[model samples]
Target: MAGLAIPTWDPETALLIGTILLEAIVLYVGYGGLERIVGPRLLKLVVGGE
Candidate 1:
């Protein structure tokens, strides 16, 4: 696949790298927000109440 192929001096290669980086950052932030919102409630449930 082209994606698995070696890097080239093509402009398209630069675009692909930028897209992947943005996706990674977005996913990381999304998961962090989810953990913050669910963390305390889940902890209380498992710890048998506050």
Candidate 2:
């Protein structure tokens, strides 16, 4: 508990963190769509099976 320190809010830090979160969400959705389109075929090819 002694080592733990809570972060104080700063507008710039908040905006930066928000931007990173947005980017992560967008990337997740984009990759998910790509996976849905071709993931099974890719897995089969890697596994050497139909």
Clashes of each: 0, 0
Off by over 4 Å in 2: 1-7, 47-50
Model 1 RMSD in Å is: 5.0
Count clashing residue pairs in model 1: 0
Question: TM-score of the candidate numbered 1?
Answer: 0.71
Model 1 ranges with Cα > 4 A deviation: 1-8
lDDT of 1 at 50: 77
Cα lDDT tens digits, model 2, 1-50, are 79689878999999999999999999999999999989998999999887
Q: Could you give candidate 1's per-residue lDDT for residues 1-50 as a string of tens digits?
A: 56798655789888998999999999999999999999889999999787
RMSD of each: 5.0, 3.1
